[model samples]
Target: VLTRDEAQTRAQLLDVRRYTIDLDLTTGDETFDSRTVIRFTVRADQDVTDTFVELKPAELRSVTLDGQPLDPETLDENRLPLKNLTAGDHELRVDAAMRYSHTGEGMHRFTDPTDGETYVYTQLFMDDVQRVFAAFDQPDLKAVFELSVKAPDGWTVLANGITEHTDGVWKAAPTPLISTYLVAVAAGPWHSVRTEHRGLPFGIHCRRSLAPYLDADADEILDVTRACYDRYHEKFEEPYPFDSYDQAFVPEFNAGAMENPGLVTFRDEFVYRSAVTDTERQTRAMVIAHEMAHMWFGDLVTLKWWDDIWLNESFAEYMGYQTLTEATRFTDTWTDFGVVRKGWGYDADQRPSTHPVAPEAVNDTASALLNFDGISYAKGASALRQLVAWLGEKDFLAGINTHFTRHRFGNATLADFIDSLAAATERDVHAWADAWLRTTGVDTLTPRVTGDNGTYTLTVERTGSRPHRIAVGLYDPDLTDEGRLTLRERLDLDIPQTDGRPIGKRPALLLLNDSDLTYAKVRFDPESFRAVRNGLSGLPEPLTRAVVWNALRDAVRDGELPPHTYLDTARAH
Candidate 1:
């Protein structure tokens, strides 16, 4: 396994020109023969003479560099040592047999039980792309790839770019400069449905066994896809940076989906094998929105290293939930998020294994992989939502557009992102980064109220180092009927005792983070808590009720409130 330091050194030493892999999937019985040709120009700042390429081939047939034959026996477990290479343009070729993977790591092969057919897809996340072809496998060492594959006569082929199928051979269009992990290929007898939306080709695919299910829900899926596409265009300045979009629902997929540029591979269960609830369908819709968001955040403006993996997933998650709410009929999406997604973050943060949403350092690949837990996806998106609320939408969109304009089709660090945000806002983004991103634990917000002669003052006490910008909701009892209360107002203010935010007249109940605008654990004051215990159902707004419920849930997990009391509140409400 290559360490982060070694990858950084290799990235500094070489700039890859292009990668051309010729794979024959028809031969070798169960394994495929891959012949890779790489052209690169090496940088010579010092007297470094040795480097290596990565591959996990079944049998190493030949190794030739710069047209000179190198011994195949010198190939180590997954690396081929290239020796005594000078400083100019160089080409390396390797011919080997690579085994297909059953695990969802490299090239996964699956055989259907009923139809007696086989399918193959690649899930080359982390560093497993080496199992398919030889390359300098790292995010920063990006290069254009042109791949050609020989498959069975009746199978369809998909890749990161459009594929040209002729005479049982599939040649993919040359992709733009992209990371090696983003390269994708899936070949099978696919049942596909194609449509054109706004001058772009869109397609959905499934195996023959699941053809009926896909066709049944094709309209719903395509409508959500088209709606999210239009919504993303409205939010982002950069256009979608691909020729077409094809989403394949593959069997036994590991993740929800891989946002592999033009071709996204999703777990086939999303096609709905059995009857599912509306919530399950909403989840499917959200996953679609999430992966579409990645077309801009992860695929377009990529992170430089694995430590900032949250920058890719967190933004996609936030955009997914919010966009689904705005564009589709899933208007209660955030409520679902507060109930399901945020619970993952809250539980993970309280656990001993919790990490910061954006860790300060990840020393190795192993450490970087561990950081992709709940903190990365759920908590990090929660923080970004808070940032949007605090900074306002106009400024945040401007910052994102600036980031896209500056670092499109390139790699960027966390500092580079902050710099782009700083260029668009008056608030101190660097300070916010230090407080919100650099810290490891979650913040706790408690409201304190004081009343003197019919005037009330409410102050929010912050328990962690991070600062919070939240909305406080004041709700008074209905004067006409005893059913629900009237919302006085939602005051947007900073927490930890700020000025100009006066709690003028007291209401029946007070709510913190009124629409779940922040990412902090909240608790009510003594009087407010008592009011909540009695009149929890009187909260008219569902969002406000969700925030309150989540606060009680957090209180129970943190041991500040008893479990029975929390359940009793729920039962009473």
Candidate 2:
């Protein structure tokens, strides 16, 4: 059912040239009509046979292809069949009506109880692209989409590209090349803040009821966007590929955000009608950066299939944090990743559903959907951070740029990405890929120290199959102050004992897993444990303090330590 050869052959046989989609948005009976025209070129070698299109059965009123009525008996919920299709080049058109889904799948219609204003939007999860329109829903069948909607006079419509309005109808410019799931549209009486940066239009929007809150944070939000955009320009040779960039905070969005080319849709809660912490603002910035990266990685050069989803998410995660740190005011972004994000990786790695950062095989759409979890986003990000440390930032970036250049406006596989990286770096990136990306489970680091004749020796024993390049810190007791530890030396070492020699000098406190740069669980020696209990707050580095706080947080969550005692310890510190 999940054959790579079949998918590759299918991709080679079909090339979608254009799509003209028309939607009527003013129906009050919770149903709407849609008509789609898909023009494509077929490979010369392919013979006349059968073709299939995906769509939902219950919502479909009727289907007609190429102005000829299709047999109702041939219809099903997932796929429609056509016999004796010619191979050279062809056009397939469809007309149907779709009902609103309450479970957040497709064409969701909701009325705000507070203001009595109604809104309509689309939320196409993993394989729900068929619920709204008829098309090839798989990732490999990349296509250009042209959307037009007829809505009420007062409502505004947003889509995957720049939009132009005429006679109460909104029409979006055709998108470059994108997957079916990334297509999006929202129509409502919206509140919008518009501006221009670097000759490109930029805007942020929300529901009319939340206009004041959006206005309050407009400057900060747009500043973050401009900074990240400028930073990405400095890093890559290619400029931004899309036309206009807009971010909309829509209601009841299933995910944090969907990277829908020019129009990125986010959950309306980000408008922030209530009080929020600084950490929440940082999170919002991070998601913005993440979705922008997808405008290049996933939208421009896509993965060939679902199995290489990590290629999209992992690259975006790494770029999101690093770019924001280099270009925006959120310079301490990795601190949050260590304290909150990497902790997610560690917890999920210990669960039964854990998989490698890049799994060897995914049999079908159902299994591929399950892979989009902590191991894919968080653990994959940690692995990439380690890769940068091992390969150096310059070469890592060079490798990424090459990958993008070679695969621009096309689809690539995991092996193709690895080959590009191997070409850029002289290091054993191929070997590193095998040990890190292809492996599962978390590593454990244990510290052992022995002191004799004023000489101290610290030896680290690693207990896992995966290899790690980690930072080890050494601290000494400050003689003037009671229970205070002072920094002594920091050592960068590769685990699995590459040199076959013990690291010399027993530190007064040997801190394993320092800097929180890698994904691993650290166990402290008796002296280091005592130091952590008493002097954690005295550490000069906030990142180090965050690591200790995370360890205590995990201990409490796992019930290894009483929650009240952990709180008491934090209170005492």
Candidate 3:
């Protein structure tokens, strides 16, 4: 396995120019032929005299560097060594036979039980793309890829770029500079639905057996896609930087969806193979919004190293829920986020394996894979939401536009992102990042209400290091309506104290983090806690109810409240 230090050293020494890969899938056998031609320029460094390309083929074949033959014995494990190279442009080609994977890691090959048909799709996360092609196999050493594949007659081919089929051969349009992990290909006799939206070609695909279900929900799926696409354009100054948008719903996919620039691959289960609830459908829509957000945040401006992966996923997660709420029919998306996704983060943060949202160090690809947890997605997005709240939406959007404009089609680090945000405002964003992102564990916000002579004041207790911009809701029992509470007021307040604000009088119920605008474990004061125990179900807003329920649930887990007490609260409400 390649370590982080090895990949970093290689990237500094080489500048990849381009890659032209030719694949022959004609043989009716397990192994297929692969021929890769990589052109690169090496830098003038003392330790850069030799480097290696990566591949995992079933059988060894010929290797040539600038038409000079090299011994196949030099190939070890998945790396092929290039020796005695000068500081200039050079071409390295390798011809071998690679086998397809049954697991969804590499080039996965599946045989459908219903129709006995075969399907091939690639799930090359991390270093698995080398199982199919020979390249640098690192994100920072990006290159344009031109692909040519010869598949069986009457089969469809999809890749990261636009693909066209001619006589017995398929040629994919040269893709923009993208990392190897983002490259994708799915080939078979797929049932496709094609459309054009806003002058860009759009497509959805699935296996032939699931055609009926895909057809049933085709309109809903495409509607969400179009809506998210348009909304993202409104948010980011950079336009969509791809040829077309293609979504393929493949069978037995390990992930919900992958944001592969122009080609997005989703699991076919989203096509509704069985009865699904409205929540599930909304999840589908939110995923659509999430992957579309990646089109700008992730695919356009990628992270320089795996350590900054939170830069990709966290931004997408926040945008996904936000955009779904803004654009699609899933209006109360944050409620689901509060109930489900936030819970995931809270529980994972309490675990022994807990790490920071953007940890100080992700040692290698192995550690980077471990970083894809609740902290990276939910907690990180929560921090971003708080940032938007603190910085204000206008400044937040301005920073994001600046970020996209500056790093489009290139790579960036966490500091670069903070610098962009700093440019937009005079506030200390670096300090904010330090408190929220550089630390692990969740914050606890305890509500405190003080009563004085004919008046009251409210203060929030912070249990963790991170600062929060939260909203406090005060509700009074409705006089006309029996067993219902009406909102008295909502005050947006900063944790750790702010300018004095008036609280005219106490109310029937007081809720912290009422709007779900921040991420924290909230607690009710004694009076409000007793009020919730009696009348939890009578809360006016569903989101407020969700926040209250989440707090109660967390309390039960902490043994602060009994488990049966939580059940009773559920039963009462």
**TM-score of each predicted structure versus truth:** 0.97, 0.94, 0.98
Selected candidate, larger lDDT, 1 vs 2: 1
How many times do residue backbones clash in model 3?
0
Candidate 2 vs candidate 3, lDDT winner? 3
Root-mean-square deviation (CA) per prediction: 1.4, 2.4, 1.3
Q: What is the per-residue lDDT of model 3 for residues 1-79, given as tens digits with 9 covering 90 to 100?
A: 6677888888888999899989888775588888999999988664438888898988869999999999988888888
The global Cα lDDT (0 to 1) of model 1 is 0.88
Task: For candidate 1, give the lDDT of residue 290.
Answer: 95
Task: Give a tens-digit lDDT track for model 1, residues 1-573.
Answer: 678788888888898989998988898457998999999988867364779999998999998998899999988788899887778789999999999988798888888997977888888887888999999988888889999999998899998888898899999999888888898999889999999999998999999999999999999999999999999999999999988899999998988899999999999999997889999999999999999998888888888889899999999999999999999999989989888888888888888898877887787777888887788999999999988987889999999999999988888888999999999999998999888888777788887788777688887778888767888899887888675777899988786655435678887788889999888888888778887887778888787788888888888877899999988888878
What TM-score would you give candidate 2 relative to the actual structure? 0.94
User: Clashes per prediction?
Assistant: 0, 3, 0
What tens digits encode model 2's per-residue C-alpha lDDT throughout 388-407?
A: 88788889888888988998
lDDT of all predictions, in order shown?
0.88, 0.81, 0.87
Clashing pairs in 3: none
Model 2: lDDT of residue 162: 84
Candidate order (TM-score): 3, 1, 2
**lDDT value, residue 529 of candidate 1:** 85
Answer with 1 or 2, whichever has the higher TM-score: 1
Q: Kindly provide the TM-score of model 1 when superposed on the true structure, using C-alpha atoms.
A: 0.97
Q: What is the lDDT of residue 107 in candidate 3?
A: 80
